[model samples]
Target: MRILLAAAGLVLVYAGIVSLVSPGEPAASPQPWGFGTGVAVRPPEVSLSGGLYFKTYLWARGGGGVLYLRCYVYSRYEGGTWLPTPEEYPVLGVYSVTVGRGPFTEGGALNLTLPLMGGCVPVATPSVDGLQLGSIKVLAPGANLAASRIGLYVAYAGGRLGEVTSFYGPGDLPPSPEDLSLPPGQAGVLLALARNITAGCGDVSCKVERIKEFLKGFTYDGTMDAPWPHIPPGVDPLMWFLQNKRGVCVHFATAFVMLARASGVHARLVVGYMSDGPVPTQWSLTAFSPHAWAEYYQPGVGWIGVEATPPMGVTPPAAPLPRETPTPVATTPEAPPASPGPYQWPSIGLGVFLPLAGVAAAALVGGALFKKRVVIAVGEALRVGAPRGFWVYVNRRRVGRAPVEIVFDKPGLYLVAAGPFVRVVRVVDYRSMAGRAFEKLLKKLKLPPSATPREVAERFPQYREVALLVEKLRFGLRANKEDYRRLKEMI
Candidate 1:
């Protein structure tokens, strides 16, 4: 009876093993990574000293059967020019690459020339050193394979090595160890977690208390090491938060998501540009500026960006202009103060027996003598060279392109400048300098000081904008509200 029972037990165990080996159902869709689902190739960090390289190993099977590897390398020149990918920049050493095929078969190699280098149009010739493999391997029929997974490894040569991965493929695979570092419930609880982070609060009583203690001693200096550092390295953000304390923006963001996941939340990192564009003069004409922040998933609110970088080092404001030293005026035999005289007018009309209209007209003529008409010369074909998006301010008022003219309400010194970005400022002393010049020119031609910008534009429209821009820069002063309104109307 005992022998029969032992034999029966062995048979039962064998049947159970067979069931475990051969499941009757297909696997679920969107297989979870260590923490979530999907694949990402993160760019690796490199030192500024240069000579860096990147490599990746990949395996994939089932659907869309084609594979593509796109590579772009960027370089920066000393003068702030950026060269774009695949373009070969001049460098000190040569770089090389090799591909291995064993579990996978190797495709034939192809050599191609790269089109761009370091973001600039190639003014000089350069060469690329690499090989491209374009073949697929077929798995043997008798192997115990449910599917085939491919492996791809890469190595880089020369210059500084920096790399970012942008794509990964079709279906069911285990999550990378990076994925496993996510905080619990990270799939759904992103926003609540972010709010807790910003508030220095959390739902877990111990975590909340610890955070409260952490906030009691926060600093603005952005130290990456300490008892109060937000996140630490080596361990994942969540584990670090629970065990240690320290990190920068990268650390804070990573830890925020990790903590959220542990609390049944979902989150991801977001890379983007700052909302405020760079100061006009500081802007670059070539390439995009890059930044990194993070996002958390909330039920109704969706994903929200969370800035973890410390506030101590926000971008600085534009620098102020240097102060100018005043120069002393030289005195040379200055005239003595003059004595007041009785009002004397109408030498011809009043001295003689004149009519009332004549006396009134004489007074008007005298008043006209005190006021000088400012004639702004509008020119055709004016060229105002500047970088894109520079706002042009004229006479303290904004104006559209030249050949435009502005009459000084009361001319002392008028200042004209171009900005949002102020490259330079020009002062116009027409009443003294240009006025005398104009008078001399008019005297030469026997003309009057009644020239209008419109008249100038009609005669020389091509220089109209240019003339106006320069005139404002040289002669115009900052405009008050009334002047600005009038200026706007004139334009």
Candidate 2:
């Protein structure tokens, strides 16, 4: 009894300390990391990222077969202006996003280069009840498998797409996340264009509409292999695209993200396939199908996705030819690309190295650190895969089966057994900073300590469904998938 009491007291102390130390770190929406899903957000020098998915099956002439899936993900905008990935940024001065490897996770894995070193992308599998399942088996005849077929599937968070379409600026705009500061000349051109494109538009929504409409003019060239741009070899492609005025999805999306960021709107470039495309009854995909887009962040709501390129099956007219200009070498003068958008092409990012050391770098002037170092969340549950499911046990006794959900409030012994082996589990809670965000939202809504569903619905009609679910959660109705869906929408 004495030992058990002492253990409980320590756990309580630990939780208190975590609550105090981890409260203010910024965290955006729950974006599951992906293979090939990264971006290079250097102000005038940026690069995009992209990925493709494939699966193949092998068959023998006489009897059997085998199947395999391939996931290829790359996060760099190859051939962009070359900037070395800095080994480390000053921690205190510049908010850092540290990407660390997690525990013995399974499935298709690959080693990536510097820019891609965030987290592994989540691949999809046949799943139920938020659980993913896969397996492998061996057969006697290995080489006999000659005749083979392949399948291709694009894994994406479909739920993320619709969320982007509904952009709701907060009634009371909160602070925007940390972001890259644009050079003065660069900021001038971007803000001028935003003002012109969003002219007569009273609000953010109108501004976004005008900007999207203006961007659609770039058109989907579908010519990914076309030479990037005629600017000096080191100039950013989108900057060239801005002056030349034509490109594929990558060019359009990249330009939109940069413009949005410069216009005081926080944004990011996302690279993934069009998972919701129409395909043949048989599993298939094409090289021309890889795609990219942009998402801008809202204060309390999170990142919202939007399309800057034209919809599929709609191709625009060809681009106008750019005037000939001498190539710039070692600062020797050369006329810039043709079709300039607004300002004269300012010599923004060319060899202009801002000294990032001493008080200058230590000041953390333009850097924005919006994301937190990834951390494990308490009460998070994961399923152990099994054919007929597996048994869940507690304190040496069987409690239930594989999908047996458990949220440990205090330290305890737990187990997940599959056939002959039993994996012992030690349960503990990991604190996170999201609770502070929710509290801010609540305070913004001006609700009391015990806000009723009616009062909540009245305050936030947009989240009437969420308000109802909160009431249900209060009454001990376990939060389900629907609750999570609602939370994503409301938050």
Question: lDDT per prediction?
Answer: 0.27, 0.34
The TM-score between candidate 1 and the true structure equals: 0.23
The number of the candidate with the highest TM-score is 2
Which segments of model 2 are wrong by more than 4 Å?
Answer: 1-180, 183-185, 224-234, 279-288, 312-491
Who wins the lDDT comparison? 2
Mind giving the per-residue lDDT tens digits that candidate 1 earns over 100-147? 232332221111111111111111000101112221221111111110
Clashes of 2: 6
